[model samples]
Target: MATTTISTTNIIQMTVNDNDYNSHFEGNLLDISADPEAYYRVVLFGYITPIFFLITLAANILIVLVLSRPTMRSPTNLVLLSMAVADLLTLIFPVPWYFYMYTLGYYKFLLYPALSCNLYHVMSEILPTFFHTASIWCTLLLACQRYVYICHPTLAKVWCTNQRVTRTILAIFLLASVHQLLRIMPTIMDDNSIIMNTNNESMINNEPQKACRQVIAKWTTSIENLYFGTYFVFRIVFVHIGPCFLLVIFNVLLYNALKRAEKTRNKLLNKQQSTEQRNGSSGWNKQQQQQQQSDDHQQQRKANRGRDANSTTVMLIVVVTVFLIVEIPLAVATAIHVTENMFTVDIVSDRFLSMTIIFSNFFIIISYPLNFAIYCGMSRAFRETFQQMFLKNLFTIRLTARSSSLNPFISTATTTSTTTNTTTTTTTLSSSNTATATTLTRMKNISSASSKGHY
Candidate 1:
């Protein structure tokens, strides 16, 4: 979630009262401000939001691991891998910062003054925005790649190469970094100087005075106006709105292409079945039969690849859809807040805006972890690969160990039974060997006849 930094100059001008800062720091979006309801809401969010972040962190980690596997690597999966990495970074710094900020309150500055203030502004705000921007663009790239692959197959071969995808992802990260730097440049952290309390001369003379401080983070007014007035509008249009619009267009094209592909596959399947029935009655020769079987096998493999690709495309569409559902409201709210100056308005408007931002943030965080579930639910290859990576090998090891432990008992039982029926076993083995040899000779003669027929 993006946040506008509020000036703290007024807060700094206020006299030190009760040895504490009088106002919230800059970039502090959730202003509870003694409101019982807002405070409780924040407390609730502080406690519950971490759980969501943890889940998102874990899920994105799994996504990275699975997509990084050699067997799973593809242009599409590589793009997804980049997204998972971005999501992972999105939560890594912010979760702890959020926990400290909300649960412990803004007094963190008093304890670790400069560290807390700088980290709060940078980690909790800027870093997440940077990575999230990358993630959004990555989703857009996935949609575009799928659209081209499904709608224009010939072009997909040239455009969707793994190297090109990697370069595109890098370019996205670079652009996001540059954008973040522009947003960060206007905002600066104030020197949090520790001050000694000297209210009482007697206390000052007797012992070391107690220390108090306030950390300020604010933007230069000129630069701030320039950014919020112009570049911010550009950001909303291109970064948030443009990608979403293009994703919708691509998704529609992909869905139509999917329908067409399905129709074509059905037609081909029916044709193949009719041809097989005709050949069955006509008695095809060995060479012709072998050639037909080879062609069918190749066709089946091609069809399976196509099906897997289509399934992945559908899964990506759902991911992009969910992203839009969660993001559009936030984008609209942000645009309103920016245009109407919602934060600087009346108390009721400010409170409503804060709540809107918080809830929108909640939904956005929830959306990050959902891609894992979508991949598991929709893509057969993803499920199979996940099972192979996490489930199958573990089970195979246990089963193998269990079978090994029972092997001695089974071997002993077999030896005793063999000892009791030694003569009968020998006679049976001899007859079996003779039958196998006769069968092998008959198969050899048939193979020779088939080879001669081919020649």
Candidate 2:
């Protein structure tokens, strides 16, 4: 067996006997000889990416529709809307198109080398990276919104408005664009190349004194040495690892606050129950009944906060988890690739890492789209709104009557009665909006109390 390793110039080199020869290719078009596994690659990707496309497409569309409804348009919902858009960009453009191009490249359906280069560079690399980065930052923004809502409720009303959410989303994309542009520029932008020698002295002699003048974006030795060496590690840490830690920590703090609130509410409830038991059934008059109702409402509100925390945490954990699973392998693979290219190690000489990365990339494609499932499953509020958005008119009355039935834990009993003219949804969310705000306010105090205790 031959030893194959990525060379110092960032090109793969296979050691061969003197009688054997290394073929030299100048273009980015998939060479049938070098890539014997292209057929299986096509078949695997054909089945996988389309599944991603359909699921992601349907899920994000549902999310958009659900969030676009009147009562569902909260500040947190706006952040979610932004996330759906960012994910949709990837599904709409980069993902499906890659399928088309990959199929074409494998089967030689369209042999236009120039076009293939453009497709690979722009569609496969740059555009997807752009939206993927946007999707990541949108998640960070959601975490930030949650932080404000749970930890600083007084500021959430002021800071977590529609205009601010829009501006923040825009700023995120803008920064992501500039940052990713710099990262990907080494791939797309023109650069001088030091093309590798293939052990064919005559072919090397005949090779152009200047590297191939035209390109579908390509990374050259100069670009790698200039940009990638300095930025690759930093990019992975800053954009990938750091944000993952931030998200986990934010959710942890939010979860702790909810636990504290639940503890306090439980103690109060137990104390009230014991007092009522001592007072006995004969003492349960109209005034006592009213006070008990107040106590029940308090219990319901506490339960609501806990339910809200669980649902939100479930979605966040799943999304962040999928992201970590999808992205971490690719990041590690790329890091190993860069290290091998720089130092010429043969630690992973086979195609396993590349295949792992390709499959992992599919999940990343599907991650942004799966949030709809998370929302629908973990949240009664989301399911209710989703039904009203899509399954309206036909099932509105039946479903609306049964909306809070899915999870009584999430149902807000503190509703302010509305005129008969108002719709059920209007009354439900109106009260829900109040309850949510109040719960967050209590959580704010809980956070403050914890802070004071620690201090």
Candidate 3:
């Protein structure tokens, strides 16, 4: 084989052509290398994405800590905890490779030359999608769990146990992993090495040398086409479209349930008020007191249940709503990308597709961290637990340190005051004793004088 000098652009084109895959890979590469809009995307991936990743990592970690607490453990919170873990891993595994590829503008070679290309492929492509799919399924599970709890309280008891939820989460992640493997298994890393020119100055001859080797995927054409064709359709139906559709239905059902519950609660309150007013007008008696107390107790219990259901329903609604807002566009874009090749199709410009994918990905990353905010804002229990786990301990430590620092002065003042009081008390007691003794002696002397006189 002739030693062909492949530039960065040619390497990307050759890789795609070699795989014969229908992807936006070529368009994205071209956009980043030649398009004007790619500067913003570079800035976003380089600077903004890392910031979001850190925030998301920290937030999800805190969420995991809070939700995993013994007190915070519930079926719903367990789902949230699983989701946080998924989100955390989704960013963690791919970010280093992504940073190296995009931030450093080194898309041609592996960051570590010694690592196997297959492992790099999994890290760069497979794991992020796998974990993100897990997160998506977890979100769907959360919505369904809440819907069952608020809408069908009886069924929720049987269906939404902690053990059952745990099993379901495991199933979700297992299925997601299997699905990603299916997507990735058809393509293997190419065994033949391709020379990549670094375009750097040579120390000896000042000539560009083939110093780097690039890893590419080898695809059996018929198998690759059939597999991806099926995989894309499956992904569209199960991964993107199915979840979004179910979430919408669940949201609608939940919203209606919430409204009905609110109206029923209002009616109960009105009836309770009317009954109390009538009893007050009639008269106050022993029987009336007992009846009123019973009514008050019953109504209070109902009110509390209603309030809890309403708040939780509202919070889940916000969560699903945010997910839908971010996911729907990405789903549509993904569908289009699967349907049309940007290189061949003129309906959507390559630049537009590139920008769309970039923006969609950015928003998806942004969405991961927003859940922490939603939980804090809407769920009082989550907020309280978070404070107790993180903030409260920090504050307590600061207060303890302050008190410890001040303890010496405080002890000194207390000791000095105590010593003065002790000395003063002793002196007073001594003076009283002395006076009594003197008085007793004088009385004795007088008695003696009187006796002598009489004799």
Q: Please report how far candidate 2 places residue 40 from its true position, in Å.
A: 4.6
lDDT by residue for model 1 (1-455), tens? 11121222212232322333333433221222223344644555567778888898789888988989889889999998998899888878788866775666642223233455566678888999999899989989999888888878899899999999999999999999998888777654433332323232223333432222333234444355565667678777877778878888988888888899899999999999999999899999999999999999999999999898888888988988998998887777677677676255543375576577778777887788899999999988789999999899999999989987979688788888888799786676577877777887799999999999999
- TM-scores, in order shown? 0.73, 0.67, 0.79
Candidate 3, 31: how far from true, in Å?
Answer: 13
Question: Measured by TM-score, how close is model 2 to the native structure?
Answer: 0.67
**1 or 2, greater by TM-score:** 1
TM-score of 1: 0.73
Q: lDDT of each structure? A: 0.73, 0.65, 0.75
Residue 27 displacement in candidate 2 (angstroms): 7.9
Q: Give the C-alpha miss distance for residue 432 in model 2, angstroms.
A: 56
lDDT string, candidate 3, 1-455, tens digits = 11333444322443333343342222111112333464666677766888899999889988998888999889999988898898889888878856776688764333332235556668856998999889889989999999889878899999999999999999999999999988766554433223444442221233332222232234534455666778888988898989999999999999999889889888888998898898878888988789789979987997997797689789889988988998888888888888785235656766687688779878888898889999999989999988878898999999999997978688789899999999997786577876777887799999999999999
Off by over 4 Å in 2: 1-33, 36-40, 104-116, 183-224, 281-292, 295-306, 342-347, 394-455
Model 1 per-residue lDDT at 263:
98
Candidates by TM-score, descending order? 3, 1, 2
> Which one wins on lDDT?
3
